[model samples]
Target: MKQIGNVYLIAAISIVGGGLFGFDISSMSAIISGDSYLCYFQQGPLNADGSCSGPHADVQGGITASMAGGSWLAALISGLLSDRFGRKKAIMIGSVIWVIGCIIVSASQDIAMLIVGRVINGFCVGICSAQVPVYISEIAPPTKRGRLVGAQQWAITWGILIMFYISYGCSYIKGPAAFRIPWALQMIPAILLFFGMMFLPESPRWLAAHDRWEECERVLILVHGKGDPDSPWVAREFREIKEWCEIERQAKAVTYLSLLSPKMINRTHIGLFTQIWSQLTGMNVMMYYITYVFTMAGLTGNTLLVSSSIQYVINVVMTVPALLYVDRIGRRPTLLVGAALMAIWLFANAGILATYGTNPGPGGVDGIPEASVSVTGAPSKAVIACSYLFVASYAPTWGPVSWIYPPELYPNHVRGKAVALATSGNWAFNFALGYFVPPAFVNIRWETYIIFGVFCVAMFFHVFFIFPETAGKPLEEVMEMFEDPNGIPYLGTPAWKTKNYYSATARMEHGEGLEKKMSMEASPERHEVVGAKEQV
Candidate 1:
């Protein structure tokens, strides 16, 4: 039996898929606002400054948002593909699609062509978003899984930081080709992923679920070592996979709608809402539109450029702490703690805006309000500090752990479909956030913070109540824990309202009588142990 000790390296390698995701997202922000690309429009209702105004401007905004919109559509589809195919295969396909999209975008002559390219790129990203964490989690040992999977978030942040730097660099380029270079640069990593993944192994759990026993054993030997397939160590794992696959096969006709069935409803609800709360936390809006937020905060001078760079730095730095503590501190604590801190910072920011966000020059434009908004009340120093704090909080908590949790929670057989469903939900909310933020910022910036703040508060109960603590536990054990809806240990539930964790545990402990009641959910045995040791 071969014992793999440096699981982190394996996990980190898998998370390169996430770095690709970040680079794809951040690379565009610089080019999106560049003048050379926008100047190609000959028919322009020109502003006095020679920029397009009115309808032309609206068209440009849609074109820019379409990249994100394309990604949303891609996110929805990738989830299904990742589940139906293997995670590694889905990743390989995404890389290929990404290269194709980059080619289309770099060569685009018109708005329509660019939109098509962005849509393709978005789909590639969606697949990465759903599959990278799954790959990382499956490859990692349980004790190190959280930290390793969390590295995906770190890689993503690093990608964003690289994008910010690249954007800053390209801003100085004078021609259309200059802007196109940044967009073209995205193909490099996508190409690497395509070539690199061909050498990687399929997830053993994924193989086992598919009923490829011999292949599963080979992967196990390659990854963990030749162990007694029947030893207690491997037995639990083998048993769990067989059981899960059986449950999944029995529910063979289960469509996405069947997720609403009583047998599957709790998992569905958790899957949907977890993604919702993840986005409602305002992470993407903050990332995709940081410049707009800074400008709104009235930090529009050189300060705006500096602040954007600072956010990139903060995001990267925060990932270090998250990677260090995600497994150590536990998943729920990291997220809830980050959520609470995020709420407080947001409130402080909102207050800063309210107190000092007056339109420049004391007030009115004739009879109406003028552009009197200012960020004068809060010191520049304070604003900078708060920005870092917010970024740091999000980096460690919502940023990493959210990606880590879903794959661990779902049974391997349904992981692809379920994660696809969850990530698709994420993209849907992502689209809503992107589409709605302009209006929200225009009419009620402070109110938007309040709404996000409300989501932060709700996350506390959601984490403590519904979400499981997946640190130090194998995927099989975690799924078993969540299989029973009545197994949840949280507030406002019928079980906990009347009692506590001990009482809930007691009830579960004595539920052997009810075990038979769940017989219909049990899987048929199809595995047998051969001569192998328990550990490598």
Candidate 2:
């Protein structure tokens, strides 16, 4: 077999993990409203006589909530597990869980069984979500890192598109087949990931951390071939790892509470808030509850389905531009533009509904009056157009960039815990919006969009004030940026000048000295791993 560049090959493995994120998300969307899923334990559709017979509403809610809750819990656990066990192992274990979950889902006999299956799938998704980005971020070169790590978002969009088509096709079929077919189909990707991962290389950063320098070197040689394994270039890599490790070892003992200590606090804050802002930006509300959103907007029947699908299709289409421009144009500017526009669109939607969304004369009695259908002073077409525009702007910027930011922000040592904390926050907020959006729309109507608008406005300020430009930098350098959070405004300064900006005394006080220690321990090991490969 022909050998490929280590960088490209690693990227492919990262994409496999990303694909699992997509598959889980897509499969759930397809099954959420399906009868077989609702009926697996007697939660079927209402009988022809319109009797209250099948699954109780509470049971259905439990099934759906269990799946989502499982993911929420998994996101929290995955971080610590990935940190301790290594990213590749976490991913492989996640893939195994994914296969198991799919099997459970396919064979589920009752509502309780189906809910349990979904929880397992959620666990898998959470694990992959936490580790995949870390693996990609660690393995990718500084120059291509943004684009490579950003592939997770691209994979998600592709999954969303595929699921949309799957649902579109399934809708044409009858009975249990519609949902069951899509759920069964997900096993293919799960199996592929299982086998694909078996052949993939481990993250070099991970190897360096575990005192396996030689493995790190061989992997680097494969990834960065045509160079001396012991060259100066390689020396820089070892130095960085050594420095990081030394710092970790000397940081006066890192406990879970230490994540909030002065040295690490900013990073913890960044990770926490990024995830918070990502969820609060209302993206999940649009993805998970768009059908209900549209239905409340006076859309119904097939039009509702098609309109919702168009939103998903737009989400899928916009990811291409997001991947292309995120690294080029940078994270802050993209999010700022998107968030500002989203706020305006949300307000406009609310305004239109408040002014003209009234259903006069008992359900409005169909096309009784064109004037009644018209939103006060606003064209219905215009309102709908603006809503779509909001989606387009969000998809290309805030949507994918949100996922890209957290993995890039934290240092390698704390990345897993930081990512876990951040993503768990994300899913928790997602659960809130998922549970609330439907009720919000029903009870408050236009006011629901207003709340989202408010959050977008808040996000605009948060991104501008705190987020760093992570594009085109090595993970080590990215972590270094956090050493002086106050210096983010001077990112364009030369490296030496930036180093000079931090007082040597302050660096030591803030645990820079400790980072140096942890990073070095792996250097000898890295050399051994690389050198051994040469001898072989």
Candidate 3:
């Protein structure tokens, strides 16, 4: 019970890193569209009515993309840092960086300063995004892993929802201080995470890998037993971990190049493409630009803010179902169902926008349409409804699933690098979307939804034909799935429907197979020694 408590506490604190990630996603959406922001950034002259006077699409995209760009680089390197210094330390370093970034962003005097601040924050996000899930997966039992790791995504949604409301409340304030207050508020989670992590135990897997067997045993007992290292369940789990660490130590030294081995490549591909497909789903388009989207739907001022807040609320509420059921229902099913639902909503949104939506007039600035002149009734409401449905579908499936899938795919030796590469893919594509969406909306209007709709269809096929089921399987057994040629013979079949899918670890737990294999591999003389003992 205490062990489980520790796991939840660690997860709770660690996911605040995810909250900082979410806070940044929508922070600029509200601030960048404001008149004070425009005037202060010097993008162009302000109107007599106090609106941005001209298009500043480039500036907007640059500011948003800069964070992703920094994250891209940071994610690529964070794996090395985490592997060397440990996941907890990497997260603490990131939290400190996050505080630094929040201070800089809150105090920015110009666009350049703002970009630098956002980049620093993005760098922190990169480190946390890659490390948090790895840390959670290491600590959580397989049965609870999905929900626990899923908490990171929940934190992100909460961060987005909270920041969205904060930005909205501050939208009423009259100066740069409006945006500064929200930017400064980002420091709260970072501070909490940094201080909270100081008391948590380091990953037991990492400890075993470093040959700190005593500490590893203690942590496992604390996490898996009642502070009794000799408890049967704890002994079995620790033995397996130690055995795997020994095997890895004897096989080959783990390095970046080791990921290219045939055994690891498939898992690597799964991790990388999952993140890529997630970005292609177009969730961020709505997440980072809900106010802009609501504006296009003919809402303005406080009305737009309230409507956007509803979208985020729906996101937070729907995510709860996923937390409850992802382990029960499994990862692949949720993803396939989500992709199909998101596709339908995307197409419906596109159809509504194409037929009845309005484009921004030539004089509009920063992608906000000038003076609502388009459909105001049923079509507008339909577009809003479809957008909400899209977010609802995403909240449960891709939103949390993407973060949960990658870290579990690799063995401990290269788990850090695999997650780093996958996270970098997430941010790289995230950067592309962030950089392009404002311009895409301005130039293509409703067609943007069509593009995302196509990506959703593609995602459905990918999940059905490619992703293997990992739920309920132990981490070491999951590695064997990738290595076994017949483990995933029916990729298109739901995991529950597949006959070939079975848990080797569960079979071991039942005393069916592992003892024989361990004896054969770990000690050929075990049988002889047992025979001699029996004869005596």
What does candidate 3's lDDT look like per residue over 168-252, in tens digits?
7887888888889999998988998888888788898988888888988888778666576555556666777887887788768
Using all chains and alpha carbons, the TM-scores for the candidates as numbered come to 0.82, 0.81, 0.90
Give the Cα error of residue 437 in candidate 2, in Å: 1.8
Residue 519 of model 1 has an lDDT of 42
Q: Rate the local accuracy (lDDT) of all candidates.
A: 0.66, 0.66, 0.79
Error of 2 at 324 (Å): 1.9
Rank by lDDT (best first): 3, 2, 1
Give one digit per residue, the lDDT tens place, for model 1 in 294-386.
655556535666677788888988788878867767777787798899888777767776766655432211111111234543544455567
Clashes of 1: 15
User: Which portions of model 3 show Cα errors greater than 4 Å?
Assistant: 1-5, 47-50, 364-373, 485-536
Pick the winner on lDDT between candidates 2 and 3.
Answer: 3
- For candidate 2, write residues 1-536 as lDDT tens digits: 23344665666656766666566555655555444444444544544445323344344335544655777788878877887788878888888887888788877766667778888987887788777877877776654566677777777777776876787678667666777677777777767776776676777788877778888877666665434665544555667777677776655643457677766777677677777777777776667655545544566556766777787778778777877767767777787898999999888877877776765431121211111232423355556666687778788887777677788877667777778777777777766665665445444556777898999999888777766666655577666675544655423323223221122233234333335444435676445434423421
Ranking by TM-score: 3, 1, 2
